[model samples]
Target: MGAPDYFVILAEMRTGSNFLEESLDAAPGLKCWGEAFNPHFVGAAGRREMAGIDIAARNADPLRLLAAIRERTDGVAGFRLFHDHDPRILEHCLADPRCAKVILRRNPLDSFVSLQIARRTGQWRLGAKGTARMAKIRFEPADFAAYLDMQAAAAAAVTRRLQISGQSAFHIDYDALGDVEILNGLCRFLGARGPITAASSRTRVQNPAPVSQKVENPEEMAAALAELSAQEPFGAGRSRSLEPDRGARVPTYLVAASCPLLFVPLPGGPRARIRGWMEALSPGGAPPLQGMTQKSLRRWRRTNPGHRSFAVLRHPAARAHAVFVERILYPGPHCDMDLRESLRSHHGVPLPEGPPEPNFGLDAHRAAFLAFLAVLRGSLQGQTGLRVPPEWATQSALLQGTAQVLLPDRLLREDMLAQELDAMARPFGRQASVPPARTGAEATLSRIHDPALEEAVRSAYQRDYMMFGFEDWRPEAAG
Candidate 1:
């Protein structure tokens, strides 16, 4: 039998990629390199060594390493690429006609649960000398929502990439990965003889029990999962372009606009907490400003507007990075997914399909961040204008053009959140429980060391830097 050129296992973590890779490797005349772009261990890592080159030298340059591996492999050479792997390699594989693409999908809910369990126990693969720790993992509804959205966006991205590139791919779901026919079909697709026997998988399923047993909040999990299933594709049936309708309800917490007593949740801002506190304080509950207009804003001003307005200023780069993490990187099924979908539809930028794993390097993330910034820049320049979700919009734009447009009587720094809360609370005759904001920005920034991306972020948020006096701020400060 003649060997085919090459193939790519386009998949995500905990999505039965190990099983698929091992099964393919078992086939004669087929060489499967596992995670060739993995930053720490290049060229199949612990499983098989490349002929002679030092992997560490090639690790930094994925393109060189892939070329070296392809040259060295004697058979039909292929490599497994998770969504979070080095994007340069992924793009190269996608663009090359010699490479056959195999897109693997899975039930994201199950995969997410499995990943969570594994993360807690520190047991990612099978046969490792580790016992199952029966600790119940705390369930954050926002986190679960983000994971669901991210998985959906990733799956959609794979389809979109294939369609746009016009690449003929062998699509298989994780549930069908163990099937004999599927395995043999993959071999045939690679131009190899079938009847390939299955190999024992190195990765084990962490959660053997039902989903209910693993999570601390079973009801919440079940509800969230159900809601996720019931939802439509990330941005399906919605307008492809970023056109915020005239009658679109602007989400705001009303206190006053003239005296400027209200707080506007600028995407990724602390508007939610402010709104929640307002509802608790008001006798009628947070006022229904559904049809909020200039008229309504004026009325609010006339009634209670009296030197109560204050705005917290988050660092522009930090806010942009936070938006990328929440909306593009770990988006929920609703708004975050919508923004990602719009980016894909309008700018052809696809969010990574893989969940943010601890071991995955920053190359792919930097690519995503750049893409996200590009879309954001476009949105700002486009007809949609400042009518974007707070995450992508400039802080200056959100505040309606810096101090010149809508100057706050009192401007407080987001880093000094406790003081801001205390000041706001004193006016309402209640002490604020200022919970330290749980932004993962510092941890995320640590992995990023690319000068190009750093400059790109700095340039993209230049307005925020200029207006908010953060021009001197560097990523090192966050780290």
Candidate 2:
């Protein structure tokens, strides 16, 4: 193995891989060859921006640059080496049996924006400017296609190495701290004496862009991609850009035999626990309450013959829950709008996004809030007081954001909140297909303030209609 130990950090750069390299280098026994294949200070630790580095020299004979970084210097001390490239590089790099590699992947949006800026500003390493080009360069990579190709190349290479060579490989997620966690995990796994926490989280954060743009000009970007991912296209499951008919595929199915659970990051810990309780709670497509029907809603009192009969026609949490469950279940674009990328927030964890610049309203805010509530509810495992009311679809109610909190057919109950929330991360219940309803109730509790004010309500519905192929959010206007 190269000195320190061979560390092939296959990653999407700009997602903090440089910060990771810097951290790894800070340790006593480690060194990094920034990007093995790229032109410039190939072995210079930390970030390499085209603005300051020379790509032409490295391009002439990248090997010389690689050598300059003390490549294989580790062949002696058996020290660790970190290369932040894709897994595919093994095809070119002569493998020394002493080395080990890890595939570190990150959310695509984080990389895409960085890439866009690199291309536009004229200093990308594999440097493809995302800027509008006056003249096209075949391989210069002027658009999203080029970015995807680079990302794909790295991913494919990593996968290939794993299959062909029995390299000690790992798939890592990126953080502002770079690959610290994964690197440490691998070091521990390999029994290497390396410092995992050499760099602090604060030092890892790069100067963030003043404003992270969610939607660029409509004409240049793909509407479908924009709808699915505001930042990066990582969450997309089996659904593709052109295939509208494949909406059902969006809802995730947690068939343990088919798909393995993911290890998401948690605030308090290094790696979040893996569990599946969403399936248990929403097995059948949402508690089969006598879903809103025109006749039943019109004759409210008659439909209310029993205590189990009256229910809020539309529940915000239900909407949120349905959307959340769909993502956890099949994960497709047609399942629900919240599952779409448009809902992702610019600052925080992926919160739902609303309509573009032209139209912004309180009702839309309400709907968005309710959708968030659903996320909270669906994600809850009795961790809090919130629970899906046993008679949720039919009776009992609470205002969740703008939408009513219609409990699932089963109640989460004040008492079972703990048990239910503990069961939050997994799937629950039987599978049932939810067909579209004919119409909504006639009168919407006149308390909504104004009939026209309902236009804002239409924001949630209209957004759903446009994104998921659903009928509407809750159309109460007319037949």
lDDT of 1 by residue, 118-150 (tens): 688776665422344555786666886888777
Each prediction's whole-model lDDT (CA): 0.61, 0.36
Give the TM-scores of the predictions, in the order they appear.
0.44, 0.37
Which runs in model 2 stand beyond 4 Å of their true positions? 1-5, 44-94, 118-142, 175-183, 189-194, 202-212, 218-222, 226-479
Provide the clashing-pair count of each candidate structure. Answer: 2, 65
RMSD of each: 23.1, 16.9
Model 2: per-residue Cα lDDT over 312-367, one tens digit each:
12332234333333332223553334434433432122333432333434454344
Model 1: runs farther than 4 Å from truth? 1-3, 43-56, 128-135, 199-204, 229-479
Q: Poorest 10 consecutive residues of model 1 by lDDT? A: 236-245
Best model number under lDDT: 1
Top model by TM-score, which number? Answer: 1
